[model samples]
Target: MSTQVFYFVATLSILFSLMVIFAKNPIHSVLYLILTFFTFTVHYVLLNAQFLAVVNFIVYMGAIMVLFLFVLMLLNLNKDTEPSKSPLIKIVGVIAGGCLIVTLIGSLKAASISSPLILKNPGLGLVENLGKELFGPFLLPFELSSLLLLAAMVGAVLLSKRDEVEA
Candidate 1:
């Protein structure tokens, strides 16, 4: 990828990430996170990882963000009720997040580059290959993961309902 395009994507990613954290409303925060996920998807595409880009869009932007919005709406939270963080806590959070970012960048920079990565013949059919892999090899894991997600959703609903009752 060209440096200009890379810088643009990185800038957009940073901007959206900031918006996600700084947005006053919960719904707006979720929307900003969706934009951030899309920017990340674009970054993945620029790196030639088309499958990852699409998956990022489908999983994060589509499914997870929808879930976030649904929960936010169901709870009826607004800016008025949102808790304000203390300056000390905000500073600690920023410091912790910056440390994580530095570690990730360092590890990525230290990763070794290997040549001749693609040794297989180019395949023509994507859907067929994806379906075969998902159903044949990954079927059980896929189903189990969905079941886990369902359980988590039900648990969240129950927990939130209990909180409402207590309040």
Candidate 2:
């Protein structure tokens, strides 16, 4: 029953992810992405990672996707009105995407994984351990990531804001 549930959620997640990429309208794509995230959260729940699943649903499916939809609505980019690229450019993009997929698949296939990679039973101190590792060992990288995110948010806001002087 657990396996069946896992497979169902995983399949739905993958299908929604594909829809996110292939949807014609940006709003539909964002909605599909939220569905994908929700399905992934279900998969996480099936794996017994309840905290992670809730976090995924809240942070990604709820907050982040909502932000994306808000931006899409603000920009009114439901339809891509930009001029279409040439056939050669389209072909190049397809080739690049194919190469990226092939490379990722090949790397995953060729990677050597060790067995017994997880503890037989982890204690309920998962959050504490994660906090210790994130704040102590990975402090530098964690802080840098926050700074990067801040910079990205500032840059996006600046770029999106209309300039009255330009008008």
Candidate 3:
């Protein structure tokens, strides 16, 4: 039962990830990316990492995606504005992607799977356990990451804002 659920979620996640790359419209791509993020959150939930799942949902799907959409809308990107790739270039890209996929599959096939995953401690994924590790030893890095994200958002806003000039 758990394996089936994992496979289903994993399949959907892969499909959504593909859609994010292949969608013609930027908005559609963003939506697919959000779906992919949601699938990742679901994976976290499956792993009993509720805290990580909530953070992934709120930070990635909620805030980052909204920011992405806002930037996309501000840019006013459309099919008409997008440049068309040559057929040869498209073919080359497809070939490259296929080769990459084959390589990834070969690597995975070679990996040893003798031992199944074992959750050392079920409490490891709980929020209380996570908070202790996060706030105690990992505090500086955690705060730094948040600050980095804030800086990126500010940079995006500044870049999108239009400047006005008075004659």
Candidate 4:
């Protein structure tokens, strides 16, 4: 039962991920990305990483996706503004994607799983444990990531303001 559920979620995640990339409309792509994130959350839950699932839901689906949609709406993009791809470029892209898929399949087929599908410490996914780990050895990386996000937000705001001024 668990294996079946895992495969189902994995398949859905892959499909949604592909949809995110292939969707012509930016809004539709963002929606597909959100669905992919939801599947990731489900996978986390199935792995018993409840904290990770909640974090994924809140951070990716709730916050990031809303931000993405807001930006898309603000940009007011439409089909008319979208550029058309050349037939040759499209063919090349398809060939590249097919090659990547084949490579992934080949690698997976060659790989071996040495460990059992069980966690050594189930509490590792708990908030307390994660917090301890984060604030301890991973403190610098955590702070750096927050700073990076802050920089990205500032950059977005500056770019938007510049666009407004130009208009």
**For this target, which candidate reaches the highest TM-score against the unseen true structure?**
3
- Which pairs of residues collide in candidate 3? none
Q: Model 4 over residues 1-167: C-alpha lDDT tens digits? A: 98899999999999999999899899999999999999999999888778999999999999989999999999989999877899999999999999999999999999998787666888788889889999999999999999999999999887778555567
- Which lDDT tens digits does candidate 1 get at residues 118-140? 62533312456656777898999
List the RMSD of every prediction in angstroms. 5.0, 3.5, 3.5, 3.4
TM-score of 3: 0.75
Tens-digit lDDT string for candidate 2 (1-167): 98788888888988998998998888899999888888888887766667777888889978888899999888887345756789999999999999999999999999887674465646323566657768998999999999999999999999999899986
- Candidate 1 residue pairs in backbone clash: none
Worst 10 residues of 4 by lDDT: 158-167
Model 1 misplaced regions, further than 4 Å: 1-7, 43-59, 70-80, 86-125, 153-167
Evaluate all candidate structures by whole-model CA lDDT and list the values in order. Answer: 0.83, 0.83, 0.94, 0.93
Order of models, best TM-score first? 3, 4, 2, 1
Q: Candidate 2: list runs displaced more than 4 Å.
A: 78-82, 104-116, 120-125, 154-167
lDDT of 3 at 61: 90
Estimate the overall C-alpha local distance difference test score of candidate 1. 0.83
The candidate, 1 or 3, that scores higher on lDDT is 3
> In candidate 2, where is summed lDDT lowest over 10 consecutive residues?
116-125
Task: Candidate 3: list runs displaced more than 4 Å.
Answer: 84-106, 143-167
Best candidate, lDDT:
3
> Between 2 and 3, whose lDDT is larger?
3
Measured by C-alpha RMSD in angstroms, how accurate is candidate 2?
3.5
